[model samples]
Target: MTGMKAFFGTFIKEIKLLTRDPAGLILLFLMPSAFIISLSLALEGTFMTVEKSVNKYKIAVVNNNTGHDGKNIIDLFEKSGKLIVLTNFEKTLLSEERARRAIIDSDIIAAVIIPQLDKNRDRRAEIKLIIDPGLANEVGSFLQYSLQQYIYISEIARLNIEKNMLQKSIYPQTVEYKANLGTIASNSGDFSIKKYYALREATTDIIPTSVQQNVPGWTIFALFWIAQILGINILGEITDGSFRRVKVSPTSERIWLTGKIVPYFLINLLQVLFLFALGVYLMPKIGLPALEIHNTGALVILTLAVSLCAISLGVLFAALSRSSFMLSSFSAMILLLMSVLGGIMVPKFVMPPVMQDFSMWVPHGWAIDGYMNVLVKQSGIRDILPAVYRLLIFSLLFFSAGYLALKSKLGRI
Candidate 1:
């Protein structure tokens, strides 16, 4: 009975002390809210543009073909508005050195080098486009298709003029030849010129509504990890004779530990709830999909599991550290390292395959993956079983280690 009473007395005293400290109060409440609001605002302009623009490619054309046809093709390309041409060349423009320098300086996305002459019997000019492989395949493909179309049109026009002259010479009595001056027709025949032009001008959607819906999960996990640092402070109390006094009283140690963790867990849970609420309310204002509250039970359960895991980690850190300063520094390093390696700082898909494989071993990665599965993927409980099981296992391991550490330290004192 005395042990139970003493534990409660210590727990209550700890709570009062935390509440009295302005820094603790801010860390518990205000800091999390500010982080969420600031991050949301910072990401607002990144992917939510109303007027989308297709990226225009700058192409350097080196026409070494000393023919009128080559100049006409170059003129047609410049008039297309799809390419920006650079053309001040004192020497051979298609030389290896010139093309390499043009690409290095970012003066052009690609360079078209028309060979001086065709040595082969085919008589087709050797046109090679030197391109930056780092550019999107779409841009590179667009330039190739445009060049092919120009060559095809020039050949077709030349062929038609020759056929007209041949007919006039073969039969002097034939009707006078006159060119049809209508707009050029599409080679594919499936689309008109107007439709092709419109399609070329269109842009693809870069970011999706579903991606924005998942942002709350990221924000919630970040706050959970940061708040877990408080566990170190709890460990400090134990080392400094606080837990020893409680052990002599009537309160159960188990209940006292529960009380100590409950406040921090609730703080994390509240932060998750606030981020979700803000996402639901403000997503529509920014032309994003409104947060869908599907499977609220699943979301709640997942959030609870994540919060429990974070608290367990905190407890483990506190029990392991000898002093408050050491605990704080160690917790900060752990949190930062986990956040970076676990995809909190960068998306997992963008990471190298090796890093992606390595992240699976980290607890934060499991937590983030589980939350994303439920919130973004709209997965059911059964789908997230593996992640849930992993988190539960980690919580057990951390809690057991923390409990054993606390008991051992108390025994020594």
Candidate 2:
């Protein structure tokens, strides 16, 4: 009973002392708020805006086909609102060397060379596409995909026209003698309706669902890493003799540690809640669907586990180091490296196979994976249990290691 009271007294005193210093208070509260607000606003604009309008590519088209059909196809490409066709390329401009130089100079994204159309040969038109490798990969892929879709649609339209013409021709009617003299309509002999049907079905949705699903996970991962920066303030106090003085009191060290970390854990929880609210409320305004928060309880539990893991790591590092400056530098480096490896900086899907294998060992990776399971996948507790268990195990491991290291250091000091 006495110990509990003493601990509470000490905890209250510590909070009071912390708040008395304007700089300390600002470091603890104002700085984190500012960072969170600034980062959240900045990222909201960068990632959430779905209707990204990209400029039409400057494409030089060399059409060797004098046929009206080939010219009509080129006209269709131009009218699709995707390609800005340039036809002024003479022999010198059409040379491969010149095209390569033009791409290097950023004069054009691609060049389309159409082979001469011969009616005697197969009707398939040969089109050669040249794209700049230096351009952004997404931009290049988008251009290529758009061009391919346009070509497919044009071909389907031509096929449909020819099919309609064939259907209009009357065939000789064959009559069979029947008792009732009823004429049966002959079955259209296996008309190739499959291709046109498939095209119609496939062309409905062009934008992928994965892009919308992945961006929120990236935002959550980044915010957690940035908020974990608050742990450095604990190390700052330990270096300046504040923690040592507090330890000399009758209060239990465990309770004191709890008091110090509770605020940070709460801060992390607030961040998670804010992210959830933003994803649910604001994202839909920008064309993204509201993420289902059906597993809010599980998300809270997982986030606390991750926050504890991070805070324990910070404490462990602070206790092991003798200098506050060294702690700050080392902790920042370690966290940033972990964040990068954990897919906070880059999506895990695009990572190399070896890196994907390595990420499983990182604690932050597990944390990010857990959040993604719940928020992006709309998964329940069962789906995320593996990642949650990993985070809990990491938290315990880091807590034990940190406690032992702190105890040993305090014994010497």
- In terms of TM-score, the best-performing candidate is 1
What C-alpha root-mean-square deviation, in Å, does candidate 2 show against the real structure?
13.8
Which stretches of candidate 2 lie above 4 Å from their native place?
10-231, 286-289
TM-score of each: 0.56, 0.53
Report every candidate's CA lDDT. 0.61, 0.55
Model 1, 376-395: lDDT tens digits are 44556775677778888998
**Model 2 C-alpha lDDT per residue in residues 291-392, reported as the tens digit of each score:** 556677777777777777766776677666667667667777777777778765654645677876667888867876776665544456776778778877
Alpha carbon deviation, residue 313, candidate 2 (Å) = 1.4
The window of 10 residues in a row where model 2 has the poorest summed lDDT is 194-203
C-alpha lDDT (0 to 100) for residue 181 of candidate 2: 14
Collision pairs in model 2: none
- Superposed Cα deviation of residue 88, candidate 2 (Å): 46
